[model samples]
Target: MIETSTSICEVIAKLRIAREAPYYGREYAFGELWNALDRLDDREADDESR
Candidate 1:
């Protein structure tokens, strides 16, 4: 897994490029990537709540 103390999207992009990956899961990698992005957002929201 790609670890970043910074941007997750940037890290994910790098991972995608590194693997030359187009689609990741059942649909496409973009969908998986978007879900990852959403996780980041959810984390931020959780942080704000705390």
Candidate 2:
């Protein structure tokens, strides 16, 4: 799993770039990736609530 916010952002950035390529996840099969991104957003929200 993504360990740090920097790492998470890096991976999401790469994944999004890859996603734009043709024939990549045509049906968007990797739900965990999406979940991780959501988790990152949730984490940010939690941090901001402090």
Candidate 3:
């Protein structure tokens, strides 16, 4: 699980770089990643509240 999470973070970092460069084609994937991360944050907050 730790390894998987680490890999996911690495992928996100690369997507962020790609998004910034603007020469790497469409930025759709980066936007999706941001939305997914926001959902993850919300879930974590809910779990903590419980």
Best by TM-score: 1
What's the candidate order when arranged by decreasing TM-score? 1, 3, 2
Candidate 2 is scored at a TM of 0.47
Structure candidate 3, residue pairs in collision: none
Q: Could you tell me which residue pairs clash in candidate 2?
A: none
Local distance difference test values of all predictions, in order: 0.60, 0.63, 0.64
Q: After superposition, how far is residue 49 of candidate 2 from its true place, in Å?
A: 0.3
TM-score of each: 0.53, 0.47, 0.51
Across 1-50, the per-residue lDDT of candidate 1 in tens digits comes to 22323448654775575466644543565565666677777767776787
Q: Which residue pairs does candidate 1 place in steric collision?
A: 23-29, 24-29
Q: Model 1 residue 34 lDDT?
A: 65
Q: Candidate 1 regions off by >4 Å?
A: 1-19, 22-27
Candidate 1's TM-score reads 0.53
**How many clashes does the backbone of model 2 have?**
0
* Per-residue alpha-carbon lDDT of candidate 2 for residues 5-47, written as tens digits (9 for 90 to 100): 6758755775775567556653463454566677777777777
For model 3, the stretches where C-alpha displacement exceeds 4 angstroms are: 1-25
